[model samples]
Target: MAPTPFESLDDYISLPRIEALALSPDGTQAVLTVAVLKKDATAYERSLWTVPSDGSGAPRRLTRSAKGEAGAAFTARGDILFVSARPDADGEADDESGQLWLLPAGGGEARAVTRLAGGASQIAAVAEAADRLVIGAELLPGADSLEADAKLRALRKEKKVSAILHDAYPVRFWDHDLGPAEPHLLAIDLDTLEDTVAAVVAESDALATAAAAADTETDGATDAPADAGTPYPVTLPRPRDLTPAAHRTVDPDQVAVSPDGATVVASLQISEQRGGRFALVSIDVDSGERTTLFDEGDVDHEAPAMSHDGTRIAYLRSPRSTPEGPADVEVWTAGIDGSSPRRLAAGWDRWPTSLTFDRDDGALIATADSDGRGPVYRIPLDGSAPLQLTSDDFTYTHVAVDRFTGDLVALRSSWIAPPHPVRIGRDGAVAPLASPAPLPAAPATIGEVEATAEDGAPVRAWLLLPEGASDAAPAPLLLWIHGGPLSSWNAWSWRWNPLLAVARGYAVLLPDPALSTGYGLEFIARGWNSWGGKPYTDLMAITDAAVARPDIDETRTAAMGGSFGGYMANWVAGHTDRFRAIVTHASLWALDQFAGTTDSSVYWQRIFTPEAMTEHSPHRFVRDIRTPLLVIHGDRDYRVPIGESLRLWSELAEHHAAADGSTVHRFLYYPDENHWVLKPQHAVVWYQTVFAFLDEQLHGGEWHRPELLG
Candidate 1:
């Protein structure tokens, strides 16, 4: 058969995507969530799908709903549990919040298991206890029961009160306000709720009618029938709150349950002052008693995983970064009794993103960023040297080891393709699993380039060249900077994709500068507290190396980035006029203003002082910008905030009007988008405007605005 042809931007945006893989305990089955655009092509909706772990058959869709489903996990009994906001079987309207749903192993219609007022946000099944589950839910302050929580929310809505009173540090997260409701851990006994589920399922219509009447009743009591046909008196056990009252305001990153289902461990933010400082705490599932398992003043511990025997716990630890240096991460393991704690892979330079213990608890298998790729590593519990399991240019994430066969399964992707599930053998061989929605073939060829930074440190990057470009006809170069100045360019990104630029006949350069990870700590320290110093120079040096290639056009090059990369693009604008155009998205203009107004103000304030801000801020050098600039921002962004973009556009406009040179400036604003343009159509428009701007600046084409904006 002929290979699938690479088509237009719509084809790229319309491709189906999969994420969040879950393997059954027996390893016979694996479930994943697939996202595809809805019929209207306005947004994407997710659905649950399953595939055989042994690759015996193709993948099949499991559940379908307009409201969508996510967070799939297999219970101890091999049943599938997921979260969705679908309406009840009685045809009632769907709730705005998500609810826990269960699909029996025997094969039947999935039924709602939890009817909490706030609904469920996340869930995890106990490894040992087949009938126990831990769920995360949001609750208003002083509200305990689900009924009371519902009443309070209704009252707030009736009063039209949208204000949130804050007495603590952070008031907002990445894209949403954190205040009015806080997330808490709740323990539910699934065995005890079985009868309640049957009762609700049998008389769903009657229950819906009663619920409607209860909404109007002031007493908050529902009338019930007294006959045999009446629904059994369904009473739900009160769920225990694991987080303490004082720490209820803080949010937990991950939670793991012991094998006996008696204890729960959570990685939570304990300090209100420090930014991203977390500690692991063990909570008694029944008594709600908490014990500090690992707490260090200068280090943060996260990603706790319990052993099957309930004898050991493993987690990742990294020391806080100071203004002078960067810190490396290490894997640490300790007995459940808090004894004989030690660090594994202490000498390894790669940083682990996710970790899971083997079936026998003999070793840990983890995925870490190495060079320009994310590879799997096996570390023994005996403190031996870590073994690299997989070596490829692709990135792997959401790794799961099948207990029955000892085979590893992960979502792997590269610059040439999107993410898909694959089986990794013990010898590091990878085989693609049977996929129902495979990605299209690559339209461009990718290669690597390396250069030496000013400090003699090795800087590497991925270069994507157009298919037919040669010495006779060179492709225009687009130097793209990645976000998370702390992150590596090792993984496939859906937001800042490079394939889009390559499809437009441009050579894209993805560089890992000084602040990028996967290199040692010393490399990161080179740019610590000095965003524009070593990092900027390293980017320039690497770009020079890439553009020197015969197939790249150095005269028609452009630079673009988002977040910290956006800040770098602004810095590049001030430092050099070599690039024909510059695009900055959600960038930081004034370091002082950004530190004060960002979502985590206290955290940034701790790392940067007023003096440091004056030296590193890009706003100070805006007067030196001579290249054409395009600024894009989402009003709902709280991490970098939209104010930075506004200030930048205003200053650039002023500069363009005053300067004698022809340095054009434009701004693309999304009123509803957050840090990311999530909607399918919005993403298409984002790329269209970006390419249009680049074409006008580099190819000498007339400025043509996207029709969507008009």
Candidate 2:
């Protein structure tokens, strides 16, 4: 029998994926970042594709390079701007840091705009009414400007120095080390490209001339090095340092420029003792002047969206979580200059994430997690209830609102579908737009299973049914939990996907228990500081409801999860011996140890007291675990460090070991991968190893190890 994509890990990894969507100024065409496996099947390369906003024509490929194109945005001139490390195909050296490139709207080849040595992270914000653009770039801590930053970087490379001196709280993020370089927002005007490059080149010429004269008189050696001169300017546009003397302050992703390009609104990461919160600020793009729009240490002001007329700003305010309870996010709108802020949709329960202004700036187009789906809502400034525009199971994101027709263009995805572009009309009608990549077909059927928790709260799950699962031949069940104790199992997941399990004739259940979002603040608060209590009970209730179906075999079951879900998996292993096997990835075994060691330690510490954390920790009842377990972790996982798994491994070997020091449990360790199996080959091996383990426990084998494991 020929295997489908879900049945074959290699085929599944080669599937094309759409990453993001960006609409043009007139909303005539939308640019999409599509990724597909490269020739060698080792890495994924991204290219830009354009789809019609009116759903009238087929999607056209816009840009392509092996270096990968991303962060697609449109300038006021309708030119498509993206970030890519792709060198000039006309014969230029490859760039390690991605440079900002622009494809002319009229019709021409793409051109590099700002040539920085460190490469631009992404296009932060593009002005709607002007030729100005703000980009997220990195500047060395000691350097005063980006030019100096480039020279310093060149000098460091020359000296072969890779060490970073840190005096801050977080020296590293999830997978990579935090800097010697500070992230900065740079504002560049497209019209002044030639003049600014000329000015910079002239300055370099004068400095070189001065150095030459001095060298002639001295030992023929001065400070201006050769590599420094290399990055100066073959042809580069200068960028205004909108943020100066920044120390990991600016939140790179949450930034926006007003339509006129005169003002920029951004989220600033304010670091505290153990962790940090974000604050919103407005800046003068040209003058580099900044004003404090909102900054409270106890609360986070994030996702700032500018009004089209460039006057008002809409943002979300989230009070810090405490041991008492988790806080609900409140959507607020205020003047661009920080005046008269008011909350929109006063009693709206959904957690709105990304926000944008409507066509006329009278209402905010916001995407919020709602009952297992992320839907776009039109929130009126009059404080009326939000109107959900798209009524579908697919989660919508990166919504682009039409300034003329008041239509919305966004990318929506679900468990059954990859991200696909859709055009939403003014009358709340959704039209599927042309996509460069077709959605992959799922091998199993998706159905809903819900139950009432012991506390009378509703718990829900997505059940994947195999083709032959019936009362005559019941299929074994796999209860898969979602991470983020604060997240919902609503969207399509490249990792932790259940289609592979269903393809193997095992029914899979994806449950969103207590502490999951979209159910409102009260629902999340139910499991607050009590990870083992409400969340665990909620999961069991939903799993019980799923197993009650005649097609599912409750006796042959396994549990799996990662991160917060991993914590629950460990808790479940200790609390019950019902499951035949359990798989926990990057799990937190000891709550006390995790609270102090995790990347965002401050936030978790505040949410759970020491005693409360210890009381609910999974490690406390390790001896009670009887189910055969497969522990998975990546050494570089700082979010839930490898130490959690290391300690758990030691305890399992100590207690569950036989007289010959052999145990039924297994440990799948990734020395190079991070919290997630991001690399294509690694992801293939991940699913392979997982399936092998499940086959051993569920079908009774001598542990059929995956081929690549050796």
Candidate 3:
């Protein structure tokens, strides 16, 4: 028999990933984004794909291109409103201007609504009454000439600084220069496509106040320059001296405007300890009244959906986990007047991935993981019994409800199936809208493995034997650690396939230590402070047990992970040189340096006490590391920060040079990506680089691309 043809990485990675499903105003139609894969560079094409709520018509593709399209919605008359960034546009930012497009809901060509450009993103269709859209828009400098003089004055003030001695440490008493600050805000007319100065949120006022203090400190006395930008009108005037902590830029995906346009509901956290909070604020869209409906404090509340009658709101809330353990999450409802807030359901592991309310009776409909299988669920507004709409064992990550018919549109995938959008039949049957793509290459053998933690706690894990391997001989192994420590590799996921390593003749081992979720609250909660302790020991024991099998080679093993998993990769290298190659992604290298540079330094402190933190940090043990390493970071990742990766790379390189021994350590940075690599093009590049690095280290061959260096 002929051997199966060798499968390329492209084949397995080419399956489409769907995101952002929005129902039309009439609820009869829907618009969603589908990412298409290309031979060389995969493109994010968000065309308007329409599927009827009744599952009668075949899904039709409306827009098609390599550019990105997002923030889809339908007008009252069923017109599609969306923002598209077309590379085909000749303008700078490449049609990144995010021009608004209108397409007839009945099927017609999408046309530009207005010429306003320069990155107008986050488009939301207001109700039928208003001829306006709430968009996160930006204009080029030339659009507002009147503010030019104010900008110049502010720039001049910032340039004027006073340098003072004794503010520097660790170096000579070099002076520290402090400069003035300035803030700006504006509003744009959706109808006329004109720019106007809106009431300044207090973020800018703090800037002006800081500027005044700086001017006074330098000159020994004086008020801010009279030439400063004029204050907005009293009805919506710029706030004066409002604390910086009180204001924030709205999340593109999280903010919502009320039905009457008199309020803005936002999910926020003032500090690390405060956890997640939601504020249902009454704001005059025109006058910006800014009255708080309620400040629901010290719990996670997000993805709020207002009822049709506007008498109450529904939201998901989760208590923040403390260092001691994990916390349970629940669904909740509250009266608009801030009274009678009550829990509708409890024991939910996570939030409703997405939620929508039925207009006619205000029934609550949401897409969530219920009973270990992610599915769509429907519950009435009065807190009635929840009906599980889709009960397939396969995981459904997202769901959208039709506004008119209450039919559901959702994404479905399982351990063996790549993701595809599905339409739910009224009778509860499910069918895929697109043809199933080719399945990813499978491991030669799939097996479930179990191990006992140090305390005799049972741990579950999965092992994938390399394809075409013989039991008589040992094969190289790769151990993969998942991030989140809180997050577990679900039993039903295509990500478990070991095709990449299998093609290269290596078995893969994925072990879940004491901290992984999905088993129970107690099991997952154990990870809060188990870092470098029992959890790490469990991983080591699991590896040791797995390698004892006749088909595994212990010496040629490598390890890789991102985020918390990245931290483990570095930790393992420092603790022992058991593996030849280690690859870390978005890792926290030096805990001490991380404590200062990371945005959530407070979270680290909360998770681990300062003493435990200093003792367990990988940076404290870098001198003990002997394994070759490769590190990857995205420049725009605020969570882990690029500096952490850089610090680790530099430290390892210096240690090798000092010891007069060559150790390979390379760092790669993706300039435009974020914490999660979303772009299909960049994701492929990352996988290729990682594989190339590991292959060279394991096989000892000259890599084709020598120019790709640290």
Candidate 4:
């Protein structure tokens, strides 16, 4: 057992993570994004690096590409910007939409600042003192420009037309296909994008004299010329459209801008045919006009932030959750024409996961999920009581703040560290920053574990263990769960990593139960819409307190999860047969056929009630299954929709069949993964088929099969 990199899934998918962190409104540095694993290990590139924010030096890569870079932002003239479909170190026209590059804060070589036909698709909100920015992207709503949205995306890639005319309620999204083009916001400017880089060299010399005057007036070739029909991107300044939906969505992570960049604010969405709510608008970024700054109907106004002396904005609000529970998300703020509004932390019982403004907006850094940690708080806009900030066990995310050293620049991580970059201070301290990827040896030994809940409420988890179990070689547990049954087992998850099942000797757990989420909103109304009740008795009371730990092994238990922990691993394989095997992944067997086929069950149809979503349905306990399950899915999972694991492998073959059409159940199927199995060789064939189905159901061993599951 001497193999590390958590027993090597190609050396833990070749480490190096640090997913994002931008800061630099003169807070003195940060740009982070890191990513790695690309020598054809099938995807994961993201370049940019930098780091400095006063830990005074070390972490410098800064933008290398092969279509790599990520959404790094900064520009108030300290240029950095990012997002990249990369191809144009002066070579342009590489599509697949991701443009907007930049780099230069008095430096060189990062160019391609927006060629965007449907690209520059992200940087939503830069401006902390103007030069302007916004850019969410995706257009084509009756194409009134960007060369008629690149001639309607070159006539849908010249007529191969992958049809998508959904007049709205989520036409696909956990694996793409959301539209024929929608999400807009836009706004750009950057000094009219450096005076349109000489109008992109005079529109590439008038597209070489209109392709030699359409080859001498049709005396020859033509794919569109005479004067050009699809050649638009005059290099920069042409964005301006602010949320003109041909079908909703402007919530580019709830936008922001306005620090004298004359407003952008955002969150938009508003559809409502059967599920859509976010409101808070604003716009005006030089007359794109817009206004409804905080529209209230069923309420949502998402994470906005704004404030940097451009007069307030903040945001969060939430509101729609019903069938008797889960609501309170508050936070608020207002004024930058959103006027008055208020509420900042009014009763803050946590649930933020991100929101900025401090460094003189006088409080509110946010990053919630406490008690299983995610930390970084502060709060303060007069309502008081929040202050936490960084006290350890990681999680925090791209955080930022710094407004000139009031300090922050986040990215933490844990379950033994994976994401890196630090620099916290303003009393929270942290420091660390010098990472082109460093901390990798955790392979297992985490700890924590608690419980109580039989209505006394409390359950928690974590565990891990491996480098040798105790009390006579024990370790075999697993459990796992968590998939936002309102999420929380707190962070560091390169797609669920119990250090590859404690390097394969098992012992996992993780938990957080009763509809998790940093535990509040009455512990998520204790499993709201009763998800198989109290998140399955707060996950069997935290797996019976991690099988009353003596290095665990309650007679070799199992149980896994994916979506709502795969609907609580199909309600713990039809209510416990005391675990020998039961995996799940992308689960949710039948809640009245997943409330109108997922991808948008409108917050479970406004807090459930199709008889409380088929009253805790695990396909109405699939004929009380007695274990041996292992399903897993993907066929392009549109958020728990691979037809809910093909109807839970056709009802585990109509209740565990075995007359000859045998079935100790084991579906697997990836068909080009989604709903997380994200490449890198399908996450090394998903932990080598969940450690070869937990080594043939808890060490009875033989039954290998994962050679690409041939």
Candidate 5:
């Protein structure tokens, strides 16, 4: 096939991408969710696709609908279960919320399984009991059954009210309102659906009979179809609330069911004096008795995984952020009975992103951020040295290990590649599976640059050199900083794609400075409370080393970043005039205001006090900035809050007018977008605007605003 045509911005955004991966119980099949842009290109529609675990056959589409499907899993009997917003054929009363659906293993139409009032958000089938499932949904304060909950929702709609009265700490989450209803976990028995179907059939019969009698009296005006198919109206059982009334406000981050379907392990946030704390708790499925398996006052526990034999549970434990220092994470395992807890990989420097137990030897298999890469590791349960597996500059996520074969399947991605499914052998050999949607080739050559920080710490960066960039004709450099402050520039980014810059004939430098992960806790601690001190210096040192390359133009350079990286961009602007221009997106300006207004205020408030804000805030030094700047923010960005950008823009406007009416700074606001520009067209316009600004500043070209803006 004619070497796949060069990918454009439209192609890049339209490419089908895999989000998650899962392996079957018997290790014979694998399922993944592929998100593709809808026809109108407003949003992505995700569908479930399946393939053989052995990589023998092409992937087959499992579920397809306008709303699409997600959170796919294979039951013990090999039937596929997923969540979707597709309307039921019986049409009792369907809402635009997700509902559970089951597709038989023998190849039949998928049937609606659960029709809850608030709709299911996530589902996990019990491995031992195929007919049992645990689902998470939103619930009104006092509503119990689905009918009552629906009635309350209808009443609210009738009253034209959307207000939520919160008597808690957090009333909103990132980019969205969180209340009016609270998230609740419920257990459902699919085997009990037979009796529910019978009851629904009788009700449908009575309704049809009434309609026929009405038609006889009204001269066939209300006639019912005589040969109508049997209505398979599924009345869901009264779901048992796992996170009961007392802890109704507790929102679980992760939940796992035991192999026997008798117990559930969840990471629940419990209120604390200083903000809140996350604890790993086990709940008896039958009695709803909660047991705290692990709760360290100053540490947060998450990602609970139960062993296949149901004898042990493994979880990640990390110290909660404090004003003093950063914390390292470790994998801890405990018996099912909550006894004899021990830490695995005690001396490991890397923090595991996910965890799973080896079915054969019970060895802990985990994926961790290591040396600017997300790699898989096998840590023996006996406390032996952790062995590194799959060494590459790629990030792996959604790992599922085959219980019978010990084979592993995960979605892998790199700086040059989009996420795709891959199979890994026990011996650390990786084999790429046949992707349902193959990705286009890399647009530029990717290499790494290593430099020493001011404090003698090693800083590594990935450099994307545009095609034809050489010593004779050097490319202008764009220093791109990653967000998270705690996250490393290890994986491919769909949002801040370096390839787009490369396509514009610009070399991009992706540097991981102090506070970046995969470098261990001390590295993060180096810049903990003092964001401007060490991290800023580290970034400058790495940029210096990158610009020194023969293929890069040193003088014509620009810097850009988002979130924490955006905060650094603001700081860099005030500190130096080295770059001709800078782009800051969703940045923190006034740290004092940001600390309190941000979505997770409690988390930031723990470290950033009013005193620290005066010293470290970028707004303090805004008057010193002279470089051309582009300020980008989304109104729905609750994490950093749009107030940060608004303040930064106002300060820049005043400073620019005082210096000289230069119009060197501009603001790009997105009313509907969140922290990340998710819409395809919006992302394209974002890159177009950035490139347009860079061309005007770095190349001395006439400024041309993006056409999409008008």
Candidate 6:
């Protein structure tokens, strides 16, 4: 059977995505930002956007700039405040310090409130206090000298820093220049409308200095000579040690003020190696006595919220389990005295991304994605029905709820969509806020389907048929996979590019294989050890099933995915030759190398099993690859790292040898992109390159590549 062609991928690129939705104090209005990638391959330009809580008025754009804006909050007087960094400010880096800006909640010109240095990390309003905003600033971690010592320790483990002097890379690359870490938190008093360097939360001066002295003592040697002891004074002064003995280091993530704003409760992690997880403790900012409320050992806990009366504390806990499987994380409540610990009825979707308590209803409002994509859910403090407030095919990235008003707000998006703000009505209506831009209307034939894997396990999937495809002829098929081996691909999407794919004459299929999260706990673990086993087999079988339909052409098939999906794509090309073309983005090509190089080595080892490293790695099976493939990765990715993709490219070139003169191996690196192509322009460039690559390989045709921005 002949396969159908995808009309074009660009048609869906212009769809509107909603993100960063926040509610006003009155619960009548909300603020968010709409991002669109620009055409020059520059950056995404976001404007402050606002919509009515009732979905009455259209979303209003509050700012205009070639640069973008993000992280918005509503002020007490109902003014919408946000942060925007100018394009030229840092040569489109988005790293430029974001200046605080305020706009009328109704909508108007945004005026700068604070001229920041690096960037603002977080902001919160003082309860019951008007005109007061507490902001946190992120400065660099520590000086370069200290950083070098840390790097050196890391290199020594990798054999990159050898014991012998002549074997190292070179001194220039190992120079121990030092500078302060980019981000250190500071409290800003917004009411003064002025900034005061509150207190140095992390003082790395001693650590940096000690490292410098140690480096000087070593005379720039790559390794510590046999006489070298203590590994360059690795035991540097802790931030808490810098403070007067009375004051202790508050866990950075746990820095929260008591309801009356009198006490600060911070969670601190003392040692990662000692199985000492984060601890929630009270800090008398006034007296400096750091009292511990509870300590998380081997488990994870954070986002602690005090009860209305302040006698009880509610926090999320991923309780430590025996080294078997994932611990079911549930909401936990404990007394202020650290007694009477109780497990609330919260499920393990993810961490408490956001939590709030309704004063009037006495309900604990939580925004969790326990269902896979984040959505707002609510339960009573007394543990009533744990009801879901919002339901869609998308995940909620950020959410905020007002206690007094019961106003629930969320920012939601799906695999093929940009984020857009949606309000959960008290009556349970899911309504969109006034979108700053018109959303790309959904095409008539777009819908979802379910395909059975080889194991007869049902794989949930979405299908988008080409605009003009007829049942008379089988159409070309495009199979897309999602990243998180645990993440789910939902039915609702707005990225619109897939709609464009349909417009270009192809049907798009997104199947949620066994490892997808939404189907519940067991389903999520199906792809765990079965990385290339069941998950790969399921995808292939699903494709076979999809292609067997009268509407699809099996021979004209193509595949693409990012992250975990990328890993699967590489695996598919190596294991089978069914696909005409494949696109793998930000993929982990070599699991063995990933075991050693990834920051989450311990987590990976636990997830895949110790035997997985030797048995299931694609690096060990690279000699089997035969499909034409495109490998894309971000240079600045701290998570997956660029080396993973580079390793894949090098291996493909070595084995696939185009001396056969085939465009079978191609590598593309986005210098400024992260694991996900987040920026608007980069989003466009990504789709353009991907679609163009697919067009060339699948259709044997060339087309103008669309840019992310106009």
TM-score of each: 0.93, 0.96, 0.74, 0.32, 0.94, 0.76
Instruction: Judge candidate 6 at residue 179 and give its lDDT.
Output: 23
Every candidate's lDDT:
0.81, 0.86, 0.60, 0.79, 0.82, 0.61
lDDT of model 2 at residue 297?
70
Compare the candidates by lDDT and give the number of the best one: 2
What lDDT tens digits, residue by residue, belong to model 5 across residues 654-695? 777645665778899999998999998998889888888999
Q: Write the per-residue lDDT of candidate 6 for residues 1-710, one digit (tens) a residue.
A: 22322233333444444556777777676777676656753445676666787678776666777667777776666776677665432122533557556666565656555433344555543332345344444333322232343444444545664343321111111112112222232333334442223322122344455557666764556555432322221121111111131111233445555545445555555445412466777655435566878775576666777665556667777665432545565777777656898776745344445666655536667765444456666767676656776766666655666455556566666544456666666544666666675545444265566667776777767677764566687779999987777666653443324655665667888787867766665665566666887888888877877887888888799998888888888888878888999998888877777765554455665566657656677777788877788899887665577889988888877887768655556777788776666655566577677777888888888755454323
On TM-score, the stronger of 1 and 2 is 2
**Over the stretch 1-710, how does candidate 3's per-residue lDDT look in tens digits?**
12222245555556555555666666665566666666565554556576665546667777865565766776545677777765423233433446566666566666554333234455632443344345543322221322233444334447783332222111111121111111112222334322234423453565577567555553532343433433322222121111111322233344455555444454534333322245444334566445555555555566666665556777676666666766775677777555798776454444465666654545677766433346667666666666667777656755666555556676676533556666776556787664223334354566666777777777766677765556676788888887876665543432334556666678878777766655656666666565777667778888888888878888788988888889999889888888889989889887777765565555566667667677778888888988888888887776777888888878887777546655577777888765667666566567667778878887786664433333
Better candidate by lDDT, 5 or 6: 5
In TM-score terms, candidate 3 sits at 0.74
Candidate 2 lDDT by residue in tens digits, 383-407: 8889988887889988989887889
Tens-place lDDT digits, model 1, residues 1-710? 23233346687777888867888878877798899889888988889888887778989899999899999987778888899988865322645678888888889899877766677887854555446778888877755555566666666776788888876767788999876778888787767655456665655666666567555655533232212122222534456567635334334347788877888888877764535478888888878888888888878888888887888889988887666667778899998766789999888877888888876788999988879888888999998999998988888988888776667988898878788888888788888887766877776888899999888889999999877789999999999999988898887787888888887789999999998988877888889888989999999999989989998889999999999999999999999999999999989999988988998887666666567778999998988998988999999999999999999987777766655644478888999998888888898889999999999999999988888888
> What is the Cα-based TM-score of model 1?
0.93
Ranking by lDDT: 2, 5, 1, 4, 6, 3
Tally clashing residue pairs in candidate 4: 3
Best by TM-score: 2
- Backbone N/Cα/C clashes per model: 0, 0, 1, 3, 0, 50
Model 5 TM-score is 0.94
